[model samples]
Target: MESTKTAMEAFEKLEKVGEGTYGKVYRARERATGRIIALKKTKLHEDDEGVPPTTLREISILRMLSRDPHVVNNQIEMPLTKSNRLLDVKQGVNKDGKTVLYLVFEYMETDLKKFIRSFRQTGENIQPNVVKCLMYQLCKGVAFCHAHGVLHRDLKPHNLLMDKKTLILKIADLGLARAFTLPIKKYTHEILTLWYRAPEVLLGATHYSTAVDMWSVGCIFAELVTKTALFAGDSELQQLLHIFRLLGTPNEEIWPGVSKLKDWHEYPQWKPKPISTCVPNLDEDGLNLLSQMLEYEPSKRISAKKAMEHPYFDDLDKTHL
Candidate 1:
């Protein structure tokens, strides 16, 4: 396939974005188009270590998702500028000996965390209309991803980005995303951010599907409305209890085969609580939507498309493209 942008022409130098468990990011510009973008410079360690797997996984997945506008589009370096490519930015040895790689991306103004922090600094809480706009755009992006068979296993406010002009939310960080089709692959039980994880994930359910993402969507939507992390827990068990306390504990009648999960036998038992007890201030429509999203049974969780058609969004009359 033809490449989109070359390293030498992408940028010179700008400012740093942030550092994570893996690498650092910088804001840069495209020399050719004069457009701004983020240059994520990752360290390539000698041993197959922290930076390699996640870095390579993110690059591979971003390349796969390059064509989708709703997803962060990667600017691939071209072969014509192969020699001129900016390899000196970093150095390392691959499995086949010496090699180097660099990743370029469109510059995002700020992430959801930064955006919300900025809003809080001004003492102006996000309006419902603004929240609806952001959520709708985020769902639209995620819906497009799910439609094309990609599952963003990790969905959290931090992974969401907002552009300055329209404030349209874009789902960033594809490091944890993978394509899922029937006869799913056997993977680890550990996935998703602790607060945004689905109930099935906490129950040690391995055969998960798009429903996992739907649960995250619910958590994100609720958090946006409340302006705080919905189920902020430091542990797996705590996270489960937090969710149960809000949405009520799951029973065999509500979620069938609860006892058959890989780690079901050792879980603590608790009585379910009504939603009103946890979120007394939430309107009936909001509670109803959250209940559908946080459903213990994956089969019963609402799809991204159906969630878009929910009545909670009826008052949001503006189009956010």
Candidate 2:
């Protein structure tokens, strides 16, 4: 398939959405059916044999899971097909000779970052009720991924998308996601965004499981309530400092083998300030949920299933009740 012609045939380019390190996303319209889609065009890297591994991983996992409404509605508009595979799956080449990979997604108006900025600029707090709703939906998407044996290693505000009108939230960017329970080695330092990374990860502990994702959800929850990054820091050390400043330093009693982490030697041993000082504005119930979600021991973190059952959401109106 020719890159130029295939792109032209499948969808008409509307406008560029955002540029990443390796790709540029564009708003597009499907020519055959006139449906809007987000075309993610990635630049081929010869180092990795032209095809980007990130794109490949996303496509591979999405292919099997795309049929589910929880995953489908989040992004990747319309069902996929061979032609939508971006290039000749066999030859791995396109007409333009430049490797082209296409991921057709339902166009989103904005991301969580933009939405958060809007609310911050207006000096309006995200209502507890609204936060609860968004949290529930996010849990649904994360649970769907977990159930499918996928783990989104990278979870951040920029990757969380939303519809402008309805304020619906969806998880985007599965480039870092991997099939869960795969036999991989320990000490994989590919640390996600510093602020949202789990304590175990920052401590240089590998062999991590789905618990890393739970930590991200906790950070996101705190962000929603505080209207600021929960552990905003300039560097990895600073991020740890921020975390300890709030959650209190992890003593061996609280987190056995705390000193066993590969990088634990770097920071000085000190107890953290009280949790209340960390989030003075948050209510007890909100803080309770956040604390569980952000447990020092990944094993102690709340699962998505239990998170939804927390009493914090008891007041939510079911079915628009």
Candidate 3:
């Protein structure tokens, strides 16, 4: 932007709120208007060539999708230069002399992760009506992304922001990173809960589709119903085991090309079991949808659009969302 206003000059930091894939997220207020917003500060390395192309692509995607109510407000970079293809958010450098990028976003009251925690702490299940509403909103948002050819890659509760009063859910950190952004980052170990990872990802598939996010949607669906993670695992191997133990071990018959995956291994075999055994609270329609989302074969997995159309969400009003 041409306005010589940097993020520091335009906003006053209120307090640190949370962290994202790349940096510290702070709750701040605009100095001129006092409107509350969240600032995601990404620290750039001294040796890096420049801003990654993926980051620019993400910025454009955010701008395009933010119009959808279920997606967060766009993370517009401050004081950007218009000439270069790389519209850097590099507002200023820190005391340590590392370059910093500030991502401006509309602040919501809380996120789904914290929301679920509060309910869990109180030993209460989220109301059935509330669960249906949230799930519909989630499916609507995911359907929007997939239609645009964007894969969230990571879709855990933490990345889903929510409003306490309205229960508005927005998908955050879309196309953020593979690793290295979070403080405790490790490839697949830390910074990510092993629970929501898709079976194909665990099997080391070289390619993926929106089916991955649907798998996570299924996991989140179960968590919302039961007030706990469906497949809480400590490690990748254990995560796959958690899935297999519940869904039954996959084979050529269940998931074709299962043995051909890069990380495939010979292991225990089992028969398929009813999904309701694990997520027993769901009604028949709900169970059917969840099972489709958790299909072992990626090809058979339900798409977000189809998920939104499922009988499980028959009573939900779609016009408002």
Candidate 4:
């Protein structure tokens, strides 16, 4: 393996971009080429264990996923900082003497979450065409991941990185992602963020599939149009309630075997509301696509590939983007 120390010396650290469950990200520039990049440094605690599971998983999955044009490119095990150079004092090290791991990536200007928030602050609605483009790109990236047998268990505005100039969105933060094709250990439903979690996950369905990600895509689609999260629930129960309120409480009739999940419980009955009521800015075709993505029955949820073929994107300009 290449020493990360050498790789670290190649870039001039600019500023801290973001932090997540696994590590901190920094914007940096390469000294030789003057190319900008995002550097994610993972701390390996000396006392507890080796590299964290999340970091290991992220590096492994990203190596395969990055082969696709739509997924973010990540160079793993590449030497980063110089060996002789002193480490940045701000990024505290573990008591153990082992070196930290640095994952190099192409820098993106901003994320969809911050972009939406910026528009909201300015009281400006995102252009309809721009929304369509962004959603289409998101679907492409998700489709690519699904086709490769990887499931991005977590998909939200914050995880979608966007280049401000090109408006190209690349799916990032694959720490929670895993392969679903092969027979493996049972999965936990405690994966996705509460707001974008699917009903099956909330009901403690351990053997979930791509439907979990599709449900999140639906929530993100709505958010893009409204500039706000569709289901901003504070807790797991409240999250399910928010989903049920809009999509109606699922019954055995609407979703077979739904009542058999581990976390199943009887709750208040609420009729499904029109999606347009929440995302009024969306057109008929857009609303139809959103409905399919948010289908209560996981099997009934729209796949990312099918979503790209929806009539809502009939006139979308694919040439420029």
Deviation of model 2 at 246, angstroms: 1.0
lDDT by residue for model 2 (213-309), tens? 8899988887887788888988878889888867777878999988898889655656766555656677788778878888898888898778878
Report how far residue 154 has shifted in candidate 4, in Å. 1.1
After superposition, the stretches of candidate 4 with alpha carbons farther than 4 Å from their true spots are 47-54, 69-96, 183-185
CA displacement after TM-score superposition, residue 284 of candidate 4 (Å): 0.4
Per-residue alpha-carbon lDDT of model 3 for 95-210, expressed as tens digits? Answer: 78766777687777787888999999999889988899889888877887777666677788887887777666777776543322223222332333568988877887756667
**Which wins on lDDT, candidate 1 or candidate 4?**
4
TM-score of 1: 0.80
Per-residue alpha-carbon lDDT of candidate 4 for residues 199-296, written as tens digits (9 for 90 to 100): 88898888888888999999999999999999999988999899899989999999999999999999899999999999999999999999999999
Q: Which model, 1 or 2, shows the larger lDDT? A: 2
Residue pairs clashing, model 3? 1-80
- The whole-model C-alpha lDDT of candidate 3 against the native structure comes to 0.75
Residue runs of model 1 more than 4 Å from their true location after superposition: 1-10, 43-57, 69-98, 121-123, 265-271, 274-282, 318-320
Runs in model 3 with CA error above 4 Å? 1-5, 67-90, 175-193
Please give each candidate's TM-score.
0.80, 0.86, 0.86, 0.88
Candidate 3 has its poorest 10 consecutive residues by lDDT at 78-87
